[model samples]
Target chain A: MKLSEDEIRRITLTAINEMGDDATPELVKKAVSRAVSKLDTQPDFSKSTSSNQGRLILTSFGLNQTGVVAKITTELSECGCDLQDISQKLMDDFYTLIVIVDISGSSKNMSEIQEKMNKIAEALKIKIYLQHEEIFRQMHRI
Target chain B: MPFEFEEILETIKMTEIEHFDIRTVTMGISLRDCVDRNIEVTKQKMYDKILKYGSNHVKYAQEVEKRYGISIANKRISITPLSIPLDAFKWEDFVEVAKTLDKAAAEIGIDYLAGYSALVQKGFTNGELELLKSIPYTLSETKRICSSVNVASTKAGINIDAINLVAEAIKKTAEMTKDQDSIGCAKFVCFANAVEDNPFVAGAFHGISEPEVVLNVGISGPGVVLDAIKAAGSCDMNHLADVIKRTVFKITRAGELLGRKVAEQHGIPFGIVDVSLAPTPAEGDSIGDILMAMGLADIGGPGTTAALALLNDSVKKAGLMASTNVGGMSGAFIPVSEDQGMIRAVENGSLCIEKLEAMTCVCSVGLDMIAVPGDTTAATIAGVIADEAAIGIINDKTTAVRIIPAYGKKVGDSVDYGGLLGKAPIMSVRNINCSTFMGRGGRFPAPTRSLTN
Candidate 1:
């Protein structure tokens, strides 16, 4: 079952009210998606798995500007990389972008993708780092 | 599963803002099979084996760095003590072997190659004696080869004779490299109870009991721990310990992950993850800074030892919980010259040699990277070594002395070595002579604590 934008927003608001001041935006989204995906109806998207198939993380930091997301997403899609989740914030006058990507369908290996991303990062005047998803899980989950 | 956004941000900040990094990935290869009665054959075999095993080491490490986005600062190699395999060789032959090791290290693009060393804790064979005699020349002649001499252990007692020999050799090394601020001594260490799998240079060597090949990882992040403590503002002692422990746990886990990956790539066994907070000369990356953050006015002031004791214990506890194989001096390292806060303390007269000795009793290694006056006598250096050895013996811990006697430089004159070895300010030593004590030359018996049998 695919939930409408309004339904997702209502579920997030309900989660926020239940969780009080401690309910972060990420937490609210996670809770609502988890509950909705647990129902008998099939969700529109596949759930995350522990497989090593094209899983990666990309982080970028630089001056805030317009069209940053559009340019990055366009380049990512061209490389056959799918953006799983993305979070962006402007703090202390600089923009920070954290993205989780699935690259199993990509035409390039990790190093090749890194080389392409390096060119884009340089063109955009930002510093970009690409890492495997296992680093995050090994460091944070256990 | 999706990673927590805060956790990913924290990891990035630790590497970018803070100076957290993998200090070294040292491959220890046993050279026992290279032994030959013919010195030339021995040297040839040694060089061939190192080149064969170490050819792709730097490339593989770089590939891993790019894949994981973690920086590995140094790629180094350690071999079985040269004295063991080259027992029949003379001092000149040993120098040739040192040159071979140095050339191989340079060819492989590694920064340092250790194990130009001798283990004379109980007594010295003729080869060990010759190796000790060749150390000053070996260190002065080569650029990448490091030397270490283990003169004492808990079960073997202090080898005063070997300590005296090393003291004289250190003086000679300083005199030979006087043009470069006596920098040759920086690559030398005298240890009590040295471990085989230590990944840090100037002290690492493949032990006889180890396998043919192993990979040991040394992870360092004094800056990360300092940031964690600052984040937990005004917490009590127990809470402070918890903060440090949790932070170190994360650091060690990251190191373990990298170690396993690197070892698997190289087709070698993962030895251990050394969770030592080895500091560099950068700002905010000092062990002394961590102590100051923990409420010490100065690194050598009152309560300094207690603070260091707490920090060291907490690091070990967390590392044990995080890693399956935690070994090789796994605690906080307080190398004076390498830590900017430590250098500042010495310059301001708040820290002194004696206080550093006291602090070493509770820390990872003892009296590291210190520089004393150039005119300091060999007997006096031996006195310093003897004191550190006694501490290690009684406590059954690893202690080492890597002091530099900056030739023709007096107290307050600093010697700058520039990179990770950093700078050293010549500090005052005791004026009293200990020649008679050093001249006694007899071994100090094993301490009562070694009677665990």
Candidate 2:
């Protein structure tokens, strides 16, 4: 828990007034700790969901193969992942697919999803990379 | 698509093909409070403190890597300089501390743990002198421990006496570990104006003023920059610099994000991102390749220093724009052994010690990972270090010497330490005796540049 400057100043002033010229370093420390303990509210992180922690950017490429999207989407759906957007391109026999997924509602974590995707990639003879969308936002955006 | 198709592909290509990766995510843990009067107690306190803060360092970093899909090459730790805290102990006790640190680092699952260092740029304390005496043994006995000593700085001038001591320590470390191509010397560095929060190992130390613990990152992507410069095809110098800045800006952003994410996982304050273009032994990851791509015929050519200056400046400009906390040696690194192109240049007689020294005037480090004949005298090595320190003091930039006086190996012979230490071809050095000058060593007074304050 971190106290703001104003809160710390208030606490220090209050402690000094209460000590009334009798405060030593030890007593001041004790008073500050007691005052701080009075406001012991845990920092709530779960309520702040503004970050891109739950979003993932999935990129895949390989030789053009049928049912690749169906196979991938089925796996994601089974894992409770929501596919928000996708863009793909095909030239000659090679195809590349980029996907945006919101994994906040998914039961599995990033590692588990990556493990399942690795098996799918090996079976389909393609390469699939699932990375947090924050990385893209960091590099491509400001 | 919120992100352009080309941007997506560019990021992917940088990672999958161009060998883009975070070089190191070093956790700086201050061991200031762990010192005790008893050697055994001090050792125990140090071990427990390191484990308390560093047990999950590698695991958290791996989790971030999995989430971001960006590879982190090395997860390391740097602590308060050993000689500072253990200044009251004897040289033998310092060796015990080194072993304890090595053990703790191994248990923490890190490959390297730095901060076995001393800062004697002005003069040495009794304990600092003792620590220097213990370095050869500490380096020889410990596997994961890395040591460094600062013998010169801009404000305090050059400590030629300390340099001679460090030179002797280097020679002894080389001879002690001679069975492995004098590999122990690779783990030691002699610095002038060493930075406190540098995340790169063999040179990093948690400065005295740093917080209790912080995470610092070193970003590396020579291949990405090289490819970008090549793609700018036939452009003039200004256009080339613009191209390099844009590329570096994006990488620096990504590097900072990765660093902050890892720091968040560890619940530690995030430190600066070292925007140095450190090279690895792998092909296409060479800083020399980037220099050549900037139109240098080779690494040690005539215009090489100017090209490096441009690259280093652009790197700093982009890094400063990309992240608010850009520190460390944020420039281009030109270590010979770790860079494949530099190795090729040295092998072909293109890059030499003198040229590398001149290039260091513009870059971050000086004479890094250079190999010389086994018969090179301690005074000659001191001459080399003194020269490098003179450049660093005069310019007020961080410079270091990680030269390996490869034991029993002469010029035309190469020392192969494998892995990231890479392979260094022994370059010939002039045999002019500088001992009388070194023997008269008191202190090289501060340069005129030190009077800015």
* Candidate 2 residue pairs in backbone clash: none
lDDT of 2 by residue, B1-453 (tens): 778888888888999999999999999999998888998999998998898889888988888788888999999999999998999999999999999999999998997999999999999999999999999999999999999999999999999999999999999999999999999999999999999999997999999999999999999999999999999999999999999899999999999999998888777899999999999999999999988988888878899989989998999999999999999889889889999999999998998899999999999888999999999999999999999999999988999999899999998999998888899999988989999999898999988943665
Interface RMSD of each: 9.2, 4.0
CAPRI-style class, candidate 1: acceptable
Predicted candidate 2 versus true structure: per-residue lDDT over A36-60, tens digit per residue: 9876764632232333347888999
- All models, DockQ values? 0.23, 0.37
Q: Residue A72 CA error for candidate 2 (Å)? A: 0.6
TM-score of each: 0.90, 0.92
> Best lDDT goes to which candidate?
2
Backbone collisions counted per model = 2, 0
Off by over 4 Å in 1: A1-53, A90-93, B450-453
Deviation in angstroms for B261 in model 1? 1.4
**How does each model score on lDDT?**
0.90, 0.91
Query: Residue B112 deviation, candidate 1, in Å?
Result: 0.3
